[model samples]
Target: MAAIQALQALAIDVMLPALGNISHDLGVTNPNHRQLAIGVFLICSGLGSLFPGSIADRFGRRPVVLTCLTIYVALSLGCSLVSDFTALLVMRGLMGLFVSGLMVMPMAIIRDRFSGDRMAKVQSLVTMTFMVVPMFAPTVGQGVMLVAGWRWIFAVMAMLASALLLWVWLRLPETLDPDNRQPIMPRVIVGNMAQVIRCRASTGYLLGAAVMQGVLFGWLNSSQQLLGEHFGAGEMFPLIFGGIALVMAGMNFINASIVERLGARRVSQTAVIVYILIAVAHLISLMRGEGLWVFVPFITASMCLVTFIGSNFASIALQPFSRTAGAASSIMAFSRLLIGALLGTVIGQVYDGTAIPLFIAMAIGGSLTLALVLYSEKGVLFRRLNPPPLKVKAG
Candidate 1:
């Protein structure tokens, strides 16, 4: 899960600085159109999660992930050579479609091995490990752009995918048992997904993470513009973004330490409340026309709050449906990525002169997340340690 999640994080941050150059070179007139190149990949990743799991169950997780990584590499290199915007978008979408195995299989592997609170603890630890990559990817991407040019962003991604493929091919063991392996029947996968969705608590975290992911994804799609154009910090964008990412990493580390004791629900609920408060404050500051000095601090704080929500919510959701982890993970990831892609599109559309659009979207997403959590838990803000396993309902 850690390695795969790291790959997912790298997908966005590593190409960020290069986006400007690509837009100029590709003859993209609107800034929003440039954002679509990134958005399409995310949307496809969401859509891609629907397959591959049942395939993994049939063919084996190691083989499926390896094949996907190889395809991701080929498509990423294809992205580098594309001459037109449509071609680049198509290649990116293809890259996303293939990378779904990486996104969903790690959790399945862990589920194949672990259960209960042990799974949550391991998930938190895995999340912290992967958090390090995004923390530095922008910096790495910026360095690559400085030395190798914008095309080299894809080059680096291809190289990383190559390396990961080699490692997975060699090191990963097949976790799916032959007796339990499900055929790649679309009806069976969709039927399993429906069962996962009907479990109220599990669906709550899926929606909660969806809303939160939308906020983060919107910020990611717009952060470069928000910092460079709005705040007059073009040169400082990577540095500032990286610094906030590190703060988020620190918060994830803290979550790893506390989640086992405080439990996932308590920590996540507190984080949501804090996230909303900080987002509102940031929106107000932007409304007042203050610059980085105002926007940077609150944005950083909101990111800190985000750390509390992300992994713990996944841990809680995954806890109840251990038997169905593969299917459940696929559903949860699909919802999260789809919401992110849609919200990101809306945020990209509203890119006015300042960061207000971004901030407003973040605030709204965070508020919705809070409401979803409350409603899901029947107004209970915290979970009892060893809370009852989520009730799986007949679809």
Candidate 2:
């Protein structure tokens, strides 16, 4: 389950080290315009996420995910053959469309088998496996670039997606219970999504997740440039980038261990408050003209804090509905990716060859997320509404 979801991460991160080469080969002269390569895919994925939930609900989890993976694998290979920037972005957008399943199905599948704090704990454990891909993806991309050209990076993505495709086909059972299946009509999908959106707690957590996602996407949009050019890490960029991912992976592991005891709301809410404070400290250092060494700790700390939020937020948002889990997960994923795309594009475009813009975006995102969380909880923070069930399954 985790490996399949990580395909979405690998798709983006594996191309990070090769963005410059893609731009040069495709005749994209403006550096900022290169970000479109990522922005377009993400926005299209967000837009496409709205459709798959109903389809999965109507059919079954295994078939929809398998078909999507087949399409994703095909698109990854096709991307390698693109001769121009326009063609590449078009392929990316298509890949994003099919690949939306990679983000939504896993959550819906988890929701199928677990709920409450137990669900959050299980989600964090899933995240621990998921985080490994991003940590090594840039390094893998960099390694491929050394022997081949940028196009082969897409070839590598194709191979990785294929492996996950094979694994899912052989091992994954349909987690969605037969009774929860909804019809494929547009009204059915829309109505289910509407119910999710109208719930105050779900809506607030969804919006907060969206804002926080924008902050993460903002980093992905420019991290290679920021670490390599702005900070002058040069060839060590992949290692530095991977280091931040390592911190996130470790935090997810911690969240898994502690979430069942401390409660997801309390742990995640405390993390958000700390995230905002770290962002403020980061901004202060940026104002002081500090170097990369000084900024790394603050940013790493911020990523650690955010690791607590994503899975927890999703678990909370989906807690209210069982029959519409697919639709609920889809809408939540859509909002996060779409809003993240827009905010990430702004952060990338406003680069100005400095880390100032990125940190500023972080501060604003943290504040916005807090406000949304407050709205979700009616201005209260860190209160756990659901206690762990006594006889939960231990998967």
Candidate 3:
């Protein structure tokens, strides 16, 4: 489940280090336009997320995911072979579409068995495993760039997806419930998805997560410029990128250890409050003309808080359903990718050779997230709406 999900991360992060190479080699003249690669993929990903869940709900999860992975692998190779920048973006969009199955199927499978804080705990573990890709993807991309052209990065992605396809085909068991087989009919798909949007908790958390995702995407769209140029990290870009990801992964590990006991509400809520404070501090430091060391800690800390916020929010959003979990996850992923990509593009396009835009996104996103969550809970915070999961003994 984790590895399949990490394919999305690998797709995004691994290409980041090569954005400059891609832009130059592809004859992209404007620096800001390089982020179009990310924007296109993400926007298509959002659009694509709307369907894979419903499709998998109609079909079996295993067949849908295996089919998508095969397409993903093919598209990666096609992306490598593309000469025109427009063609590359087109192929990247298709890659995102195919990979949406990988993104949604795992969540649907997980929701097959768990809910509440137990679901949050499991999500944290999955996220921890997922974070390993972000931690190393840039470094891997950099290494690949050293040995060959940027197109080979896509080649590498194809190879990795092929391996994952083989692994899933051999080992992954079907987890979709026999009784919960949803139909692919248009009205049924709409009705199932409508439930997710109608639930205040699910809708609120999904919107909040979309805000947070935009903040993360803003950084990704401009990190090469912000870290390597603005902060003068130079060749240390991958190390710094990898380091922040390690912090995010570590926090997810912590979340996994304590979420069931502390409750997902408390831990994630506290993290949000702290995230707001860190964003505020980060903005203040930027005004003071602080250097890279001062900048890194505050930004990294804010990102660390996201690890706490993201998965817990997801578990809460999906808590209201079991049979329709695919619909819920699809809507959430759609908001995060589609809305977030547009917002991030705005931030990236406005980049003025500084970290200011990214931090501003963080501050606004954290504040807005707090507001949405508050409204979702009737102004309540940090209290569980569900009781702890009952312990089960082995049969």
Candidate 4:
């Protein structure tokens, strides 16, 4: 499952170090236009998620995921072979579309087996392993570029997908029970989605997740530019980016260890508050003309907080759906990716050769997420809707 989740990150982060090469080789001159490579993938991935969940709900998790992985592998190969930037973008979008199942099916599978704090713990653990990919992806990309060319990066991804495909085929059992299967009809899918949307807790947390994802996607789209253009990191970009990813991986592991005791609500809410505070501090540092030393740590810390919020909010939002986990996960993933991609593209376009826009966007995102959470909980804060098990003490 972690490997499946890492496919998405690998598709995005591994290309970071090679963006310049890609732009040059593909004749993409505008920096913002270069960002569309990532933006288009995210948007298509989100839109692609819209159907897979319902399909999974009707058919089964294993078949849907396997089919998607096959398509993803083919598309990755297509990307490797593409000669033009426009063709590559189309292939990337198609890759993202098929890869949407990689994002949605795993959550449904997890939900099939666990719920509440236990589910959050499992999700965090999976995310911890998934986060490890980003920690090394840029460095890997750089290595591939140094040895070969940028096109080989896609080739490597295709090989990796092939391996994961075999792993899933061998080890993963179909988690969707026969009793829970629904017909693959538009009206049924719409009704299931409507149930998810009408639930205030689900919709509220989904929006909150979307806001947090917007911040994340914005950072991703802008980070390479910020490090290279503003900080003049150049070759050190991958190493520095990997260091921040290391922090996020560590935080995800820590969240997994403690979430069962403290509860997802408390941990996530506290993390969002801390994220907002760090964003404010980051903005202030930028305003004061602080150097890279100050900026890196603050931004890195904000990213750590994002890990906390992401896993917890996702678990909370999907807590109410057992039979409808596929549809629910799809809805949440769609909102997060599509909205986040659009918002992140906007943020990336507003890049003024500084960290100000990214910081402002993060701050606003954190604040908005907090508001949505509060509203979802009826003005309550840090109260566990599902208390921890008796073996675990609430912190």
Compute the lDDT for candidate 3. Answer: 0.87
Summed over model 4, clashes come to 0
* Separate clash counts for every candidate: 0, 0, 0, 0
lDDT of 3 at 92: 88
Candidate 4: tens digits of C-alpha lDDT, residues 184-217: 8889999999988889887778999998998899
Q: Which pairs clash inside model 4?
A: none
Candidate 3 regions with alpha-carbon error over 4 angstroms: 387-395
Flag regions of model 1 displaced more than 4 Å: 177-179, 385-395
Q: For candidate 3, lDDT tens digit of each residue in 68-176?
A: 8899899999999998889999998888876787888888888877888898999999999899998899999999999997889999999999999999999988877
Off by over 4 Å in 2: 387-395
Worst 10 residues of 4 by lDDT: 386-395
**How much is the lDDT of residue 39 in candidate 2?**
90
Better of 1 and 3 by lDDT: 3
Model 4: residues >4 Å from true position, as ranges?
Answer: 387-395
- Candidate 3, which ten residues in sequence have the lowest lDDT sum? 386-395
TM-score of each: 0.94, 0.97, 0.97, 0.97
Better of 1 and 3 by TM-score: 3
Q: What TM-score number comes out for model 1?
A: 0.94
TM-score of 2: 0.97
In terms of lDDT, the best-performing candidate is 4
